[model samples]
Target: MRLLIVDDQPLVRQGLRAVFAGLDDIIVAGEAAHGAEALELVRRTAPHVVLMDVNMPVMGGLEATRRICAAGRADPDRTLPKIVMLTMYDQDEHVFEALRAGASGFLIKDASPQQLADAVREVVDDGAMLSPSITRRLIREFVRRPALPAPDGELSALTGRERDVFRLLVQGYGNAGIAEKLTLGESTVKSHVQSLYRKLGVQDRVQVVIYAYENGLI
Candidate 1:
């Protein structure tokens, strides 16, 4: 997997590059000090995924993500590069907005080298990835929210089986896990996932969960 590291700090960028250096399946394609430079490098390097810092000078990751994803949506034939926001602890509160801004997922800034490599591969293979703590935290937050009227149009749009799939999916199960739980084939699970995205007009599993929570479907 080719990667573009975007951060304002030189040492942080160096640390990330060094982590990938020993990995046989990973390559550090380029580096940028901030989101603006990352945007330019993204077009030139065409890295499969970008590890973008949430905060940077010139342009932050959120704005860069919006612009990049907006352009990608305009041309369906071209694949937009996946972005995973690299966030610090204080930035956890901004993760939801980052997803809305078009990040595929995010990781904590203090992630270990192996965790970093795994996150890159996970997003590429699964379409999204969240740190375990983030997953638990999101679920807890969703559970604690007071009930709201479910979005009938969105909820009713789903078939019974699709709702079954969505239930497990929002609980943080991936394709394999969902398939096993439903006793369905992996391709069948993938089809349901695609259907969920299409019907809900959501980009990733994270948004699916958010939708479920906000709509009181969780």
Candidate 2:
């Protein structure tokens, strides 16, 4: 996997590069000092994943993310690199904004090298990286907001089995875990998940989680 490291701090960029250097499967595509540089490198290197710091001069990670995501959406041929935001602050506002800006994952800046490597791999495998702490904070942040009524018959298209799968998924169950709980095969659970994604117009499990929260289904 090709990885891009983006940060204003040279030390941070160097450190991240070094971490990926040890992993034979991961290649350090490039490094950028700020968001603008990151954008240029992204177009040049076409990395599969980007490790981006939130705050920077010229352009911030959030804005760059928005632009990159938009460009990817507009051009069907260009592969959109998954962006994993690196931030010091674990504030709810920051987390929410990153999601809104199209970040595939969020990671604390202080994360260990292994955790960082794992996060990149997970996002590449159609997964998202939200640490347990971040997940809890996100839940609490949404819980404090005024509840939104789910659209009428929003779930009517889903079958009873699909609903069961969605419920477990929103509660943080993976396909294997959901299968175990539902007494079904892993492949069957995967089918239900894909069906849920199709009916809900969501791209991945992370989007499904956000959808459930936005519609107050959680």
Candidate 3:
């Protein structure tokens, strides 16, 4: 997978580059010192993933992500690169805003290289990633919030069985686990997953969880 690294510190970039060196399938496509440069490199290289530092000169990763999604909307046929925010800030506000701004994943800067790489791969293949702690926090936050408005037209698309599958999904169950719990075949579980994704306009399990939490379905 082609990756663009965006961080202001040379050492941090070097460290990431070293970590990815042994992986045959992973390649460092470009580097950027700040958000503006990152956007330029994104346009030029069209990497599959972008590892972005949250804080930077002139612009921040959040804004860069917003702009990137805006551009993608303007050119709907082109696939937008997955954006993973790599930052020191793990505050609730920061996390909320970054996700709202179109980041597919968020990770702390202190994450191990393996974790970072895994996050990138998750976002690329599954459309979202969140560190364990981040996921916990998100769930807690959603639980604390007031009741969400009932999904008006959208919830009607899901069948009764799909809704049951979705409830397990938001609780972080994988296909095998879900199948076992529901007493269904794994292939049947996979079909339900695909159907849910189509109905909900979600690309992956992570987004399904997020949507469930945000909509107060879990």
Candidate 4:
């Protein structure tokens, strides 16, 4: 896959390039120092995926992702490149904002070279990735936070089965995983996922998960 690297630090981009240099399936298409340059690179190279740093001197990764995704959504036939954000902030309060901006994954800046490579591959494969530490912190924060009543009667709108599906989904189960856990067919799980989306007024799993957490639904 053709990959573009976006980070303010040249050394960080160099290290990522070195990590991909030895890999067969992954190739470094280009590098950029900020989100604006990254957008220009994407226009020229049309890379399959982008490794983005959350904070930068000029435009930030989150804003870039939002613009890229918005443009793609405007064209029905276009398939925009996937984005995986890299950051040093462990608290990562911007994670949800990044998701709202269309990021597919999030990674720690300090991840090992191999972990970085694996993240690139995972996002290329159309999967979501989150650093283990950030994942734990996010889950704990939502689970232990003071319970807030679900807004706009959204929680009450779900059927019992849909609620069951939502519960497991927020727990990080994929469609097939949730299917097996619920003893339902994979297609059934997908249908339930769609139903959850419609009822809860969400676009994707990330939004659903956040909604469930913020509203104390899970």
Cα RMSD (angstroms) for every candidate in the order listed: 2.3, 2.6, 3.0, 3.5
lDDT scores of the candidates, listed in order: 0.84, 0.87, 0.83, 0.82
Clashes of each: 0, 0, 0, 0
TM-score of each: 0.87, 0.84, 0.81, 0.76
What is the lDDT, from 0 to 100, of the residue 107 in candidate 2?
Answer: 95
Model 3 TM-score (2 dp): 0.81
lDDT of 2 by residue, 1-218 (tens): 99999999998888888888879889999999888998899999999999988999999999898888878867757888989999987877778988877787999988999999999999887689987788899878888877789865759999999999989988878888899999999999888987877688665678788888899887
Model 2: how far residue 163 lies from native, Å: 4.2
lDDT of 4 at 27: 92
Candidate 4, superposed: residue stretches over 4 Å from native: 144-167, 182-204
In candidate 2, which residue pairs clash? none
Worst 10 residues of 2 by lDDT: 196-205
Candidate 3 stretches with Cα past 4 Å from truth are 158-165, 175-203
User: Is 3 or 4 the stronger prediction by lDDT?
Assistant: 3
Clashing pairs in 4: none
lDDT of 2 at 202: 62
lDDT of 4 by residue, 1-218 (tens): 99999999989999889989999999999999999999899989989889999989899998998888877767646667878889988655777678768787788888888888887777665457788887787777676788778786777788888888888888878888889999999889889887877677664566677777777666
Off by over 4 Å in 2: 76-78, 152-164, 179-201
Tens digit per residue, CA lDDT, model 3, 94-201: 788778667789899889988988988887765477887887888788788886775867778999889889888877787888999999998998899878877886
